[model samples]
Structure formats: structure tokens, C-alpha cells
Target: MFLFIRSLLKSPLAVGALVPSSPQLSRLIASQVCCGNSHVLEVGAGTGSITEALLNLGLPANRLFVIERDPSLVAHLYKRFPNIQVRCGDAEHAAAILCEEGISEVQTLISSLPISNLNGDNRIAILEGMMNALAVDGQLIQFTYTANCPFPAKRLGLHAERVGRVWMNIPPAVVWKFTRASYAL
Candidate 1:
């Protein structure tokens, strides 16, 4: 909690939310990933709440990769989840990070990134990178506090669906799933 507050105070825009994700929201986000041997990537994992939920859902530590921009949070994640691969970097470079980690593609890409706070270019870059790192039929699961879609799904040639909403969270959260428009149709 202290780490989260320190990080939030250091950069409100980067941290985005005032409070860490609630367990309900975390489980809802983690539930999006289907059970299998497929690799999973989680971006902007703040304090690893959702990561814990993912692990609890049967995702192996070796197959779960996490990318957090905040060095402190990255360190926390590393110490908390010793078996998982935790990297400190920007989500816009997720594809490169995954490639450097020897991951060709992931079956599920879960993002806790604050897309609504990013500029147009950064949003596009991050979204494109995430899509590129995903398998052809892979799904991208994202949660936002707003009712609207966090990103321009159709403009990005992706199909979006509002999968779930967890009102028990701090400020509440809505989970959305995205996939290549063609594959989705």
C-alpha cells in the first residue's frame, strides 16, 4: 500500500487510479484468460493484484509475463511473484519486450494500463504493439473506469465487447475484450 501510494504520488497520470484494483476486479480481469498452456502477458500490473488472481486461476508462473513501467512496482512484483517474469518498460514497446524475452506471441494480453490518460499517438502505439504481440486468435482484455471503450476498437480494426463490470472495486471498473475484427466476425 505504501509503495502504491508513493508511486501514485510520484506520477498520478502514470499510476492513474487512486487505489489498487479490488479483488473482485482482479478476479474478473484474470477470468478472461482461458485455461491452457498458452502464454499470457499482463501490462501495467500495479502491485500484482491481478497477477495473483491469474496465478490462482491455474496460470503457471513460467508462462505468465508481466511488464510494469514503474521500477518500484516492478521490483515489488519480482519479489512478490518470484517465479513469474517481470520486466520494467513501456507497454508501447511490449512487442519488442516479448521478442527479447523469446516470446513469439501470447494467447492472452491483459492490460491494466490507463489508456484513457494517454495521448492519441501513445495509445495507438501501445495498442498496436499489444495486438502485434498477440496470436491471430488471441484476446486482449482491458479494464477501464469509464463506461465507454477505452480505445478506438473499430478504427484499429478490432472488435470490442463489454465482458464484465465489477462494482465492488474502488471506483468500479468495466472489463472489455478485444480481438481482430476479422477473427471476431
Candidate 2:
């Protein structure tokens, strides 16, 4: 109710529509998945704003795994989208999910967690887990209000590029696209 509306207003990019409008289902669907055959791993699927977008973007519901830490949010996800495998846990435990799913690699990873809100160690751990779960050609899309790349985008031995910006967003935010740097043969 109030929380859902607050979330919608907080992240304008996550939910494309302004108030009293249908959810911005398109923006959420826009992600880093390549070739349309990607296993998407989304972190901080708050209120399923991005989750709904992911589904609308044609990312197969079965192949998409959402990790939400808040129990209330997880309940919301389950109620809204019963088909999705919404797990109630921390994103830092991402590796466990990978192992449980027998997912050797992910094609794309999208994170909306307030990386700025995490402690240094927890932030590092979560990013490292995502790196561990990604394939060689996998891509990661993350958004932040900061002017710089969040966390160790490159410090983790991963190459990062600021692909685009969404000024229409409430606080205005930038989108970073990360990938493994190419090694010459």
C-alpha cells in the first residue's frame, strides 16, 4: 500500500509510469540479457517492480530467479507472481542459490539493491557472488544515483561501462553495464 507507492516513487526508473499510471513494465524489462536466451538473476526485487518488468521484457519466468531479503516483500512477490521462484534471503547468499539451481553460469544479472546502504564486506561479498555465478560472456546491469560505478565494478577484475542515464527518474540515476574484459587470443 503505502510502502508500494513509496517504492514506486523512489525508483522512477524501476517503475516507468508516473503516479496513477500503469507500472512502467517496459523499463524493468530492459536489462543486460544477451541473445534473448538468458538466465536472469535479479537482486533486491523490491515489490516486484523490476520483476514485473523482467517478465514483460520476455525473460522467461522459469529462467528468472529473484532474491529478496525482506519477508514482507517476498510475500508481496509470491502473492503477485506465484509462478516466479522468489526466494526469501540475502543476495550475499547468491552462491547457494546458484548451487541449488545447478546453475553453472548466468547470462545476465540485474541488481537494484541500495549498494550504498551495505557495509563494505557485505557489498564485496554480494558482488563477488554475482561474479562467481556469471558466464564468461555474461552481463550485469546495475543502477545507482551516484556519479560513479557502485562497488568494485572494476576492482573485482571485471570491466565496467556506464551505458546510459535516466534523468527522468526521481533522483536521476545512471545505469552501468559490466562484463569480463576480453583477452586477446
Candidate 3:
């Protein structure tokens, strides 16, 4: 109850995205990438909307590492998803965080970040961070309201493929799956 308000204030953008992820979209994301018992790094975990979906899809809380920059939202997340390791920091520094956690690479990276809001440098940094931290065959799934890829996927040596779209979501969003150019298992 109280947490919802806090989430709203701290994450007006995220709040606008839809607090509870749609079942169909969640299932689509889970089916496209998430495999049982794999390490996943979730960025911009605002209000834990996607976090809820991830957990509901059977990814254990302990196996997931969430990174959020807002303190108030981070507090709210801690209260809601107590078992998750909530890092109150930027996702651009995910490489350092993953190393600190003794995680060599993550099998999947899920993001609810409003990449379209970020400038070129920051966007590139976040994308590069995720790419470098991802394991072989790892996948990055991100959602955006725009139909096109949020980042210059091809310029960055990433292959972007639209997995699905959720018109039921606020403003209607498209899910993009990013794989490294030379991705090999």
C-alpha cells in the first residue's frame, strides 16, 4: 500500500509502464529467454513489476540480482521482495557489481529501463556493460513503447529481434531480444 505510492513518486516513468506485468507478456519473456536455474541480472527493477513476473515464472529470488538507482524505490523493493539482492545503484556499473558478487557472467539480463530516456553515452555504457557481462549464448530482453529498437543495435554489434508486443501494456510496448554478434554457447 505505502510502497505503491513510494514506487509511483520515485518511478513516475516505471509507474507509467504498468505496475503489474501482463501475464501474456511475462510468459512470452519467460519462454523466449529465461531458463530454470540460470543466473539473471535484472536492471531498473522499478516497483518490482518485472521482478514479480520473473519470480512468478520460476526464477528463484536468490538467483536474481536486481539493480535500481532510486533510493526510495530501492527501499520499497526491499520491503516487497525481501529475498532479492537489491543494489541501489546504476545499471551502467553492472560489470563491477557482478564481479563483486563472484558472478563471472550472467545467463540472462532483463531490463525495464527507459533506454529511450537516456542519452547516447549513458545508453551505450549500459548496453556495453550488459554485453560484456553476459555469458556465451546469454540474452538481453528489454521492453520499449516505441516499435523500433531503442538503441542502435546494429551499430553496436548486437542483433536485435522483436520477440513480441504487448498492446495490453500501458502505451503498448515491444519486447526486443538482443544477442551478441558472435554469440556462441
Tell me, by lDDT, which candidate is best. Answer: 1
CA lDDT of each prediction against the hidden true structure: 0.91, 0.69, 0.78
Candidate 1: which pairs clash?
Answer: none
CA RMSD of each candidate after superposition: 1.1, 4.7, 2.6
Please provide the root mean square deviation of candidate 2 (C-alpha atoms, Å): 4.7
Across 7-47, the per-residue lDDT of candidate 2 in tens digits comes to: 55676444333332124322733654563565788877777
Backbone atom clashes (below 3 Å) for every candidate: 0, 1, 0
lDDT of 1: 0.91
Put down candidate 1 lDDT per residue, 1-185, tens digits, no spaces: 99999999999998999889999999988888973677899999989899999999888899999999999999999999999999999888888999998988898999999888988888888899888889998899999989999888898889999998899997899999999999995
- Candidate 3 local lDDT, 1-185, one digit each (tens): 36656666676754445354566666666666555566898887767767887788778889988888878778888998999888888788887888888878888998878787778898798888877778868889988878888889878877788888888765677999998867723
- CA lDDT of 57 in candidate 3? 76
So what's the TM-score on candidate 1?
0.97
When summed lDDT is taken over every stretch of 10 residues in candidate 2, the lowest stretch is 17-26
TM-score against native, each model: 0.97, 0.80, 0.86
User: Which one wins on TM-score?
Assistant: 1
